[model samples]
Target: MRPTAAAFRPLTHRITTGAAITHVHNSSVPQARGILTLKDHVYFAKATARGRGRSGAVKSNGDCPLELKMATPKIIGGTGDGHNPEQLFGMGYASCFLGSLQLMASRMDKKHVAEDAKVHPNVFLGHPDDPTLEGFGLRVEITVEGCEDDDVITAAHEYCAYSRMLKHGANVRVTKA
Candidate 1:
């Protein structure tokens, strides 16, 4: 069964109170939550990367028409001439969240407000300040313009796949081919 905004209930109340928000905002690996698998994927996007570290290049597969040269951001000690992974992630999340917000809004009969809503997403890179954790980490912040309804925002947070993955870690398997 698809989860509704009520599935994330109490979150709506929490948003209003500004206390005890459940979503994790840190770079630490997420704790396991519920699991649901779809019988079929709606779509699959593939991309390839070559070169070294942040100085590489990424190109989308035949399915997508995208190509970008990766560059380490100045904040992380490199020339910020090209795009970085964070920008891509931020853009993806913003797009997904905006859709989620609009979806929930339409369900709540507030589609008019969401029709012009804008999502501001920020992906920050840092140490994540965990002694046990190594390497770089990411922090995300999203702001939705034109919608202040706690229910819509909370529902969108719950609905967004990116947010869900960050909150409840996805099953990731790395195997050499």
Candidate 2:
């Protein structure tokens, strides 16, 4: 019988705005506002083979296909402007820091293998020789391939909630937006 705090604050703001309204922004007006609007009707098909009409097909709403492309994506922040939101918050903090370093390498059994985790973060929008972001920095390059050396020096002294809120700092409590 414990349900105060505005009844769980609308389920934690619907799981953080439902993971940011089901993120789908690869451009083109936010990808046609999350697909299905070229006047609908399956978005044109049935006219191929020497007919010149089938060079576009990454649009769906039922089987998960609203434009998403990321082959080995690890660009967290901007290196040359490929996208923003700090590269989606550095790819969600480099996949939650490699799933918490593979759950601490399976409860200390070792053989760690988070083969690929990157966060080339940078948001110094007004520094780095007059960038502009004002302040933001990240340079976490974790590629611990086949693990060893005491599980990569014991997950490099673990404890990484986004690197402890970027080390020793966190008190976000805004009210009345």
Instruction: List, residue by residue over 57-117, the lDDT tens digit for candidate 1.
Output: 9999775589998998887788888899989998998899899999999999988868888
lDDT of 1 at 38: 53
Q: Pick the candidate with the highest lDDT.
A: 1
Q: Report clash pairs, candidate 2.
A: 125-131, 125-132, 125-133, 126-132
Candidate 2 regions with alpha-carbon error over 4 angstroms? 1-82, 86-88, 112-159, 163-169, 173-177
Runs of candidate 1 with Cα error greater than 4 angstroms are 1-39
The Cα RMSD in angstroms, rounded to one decimal, for candidate 1 relative to the true structure is 6.3
- For residues 102-155, what per-residue lDDT tens digits would candidate 2 score against the true structure? 667666665344444332323221222226545433333333333444343234
TM-score of each: 0.79, 0.22
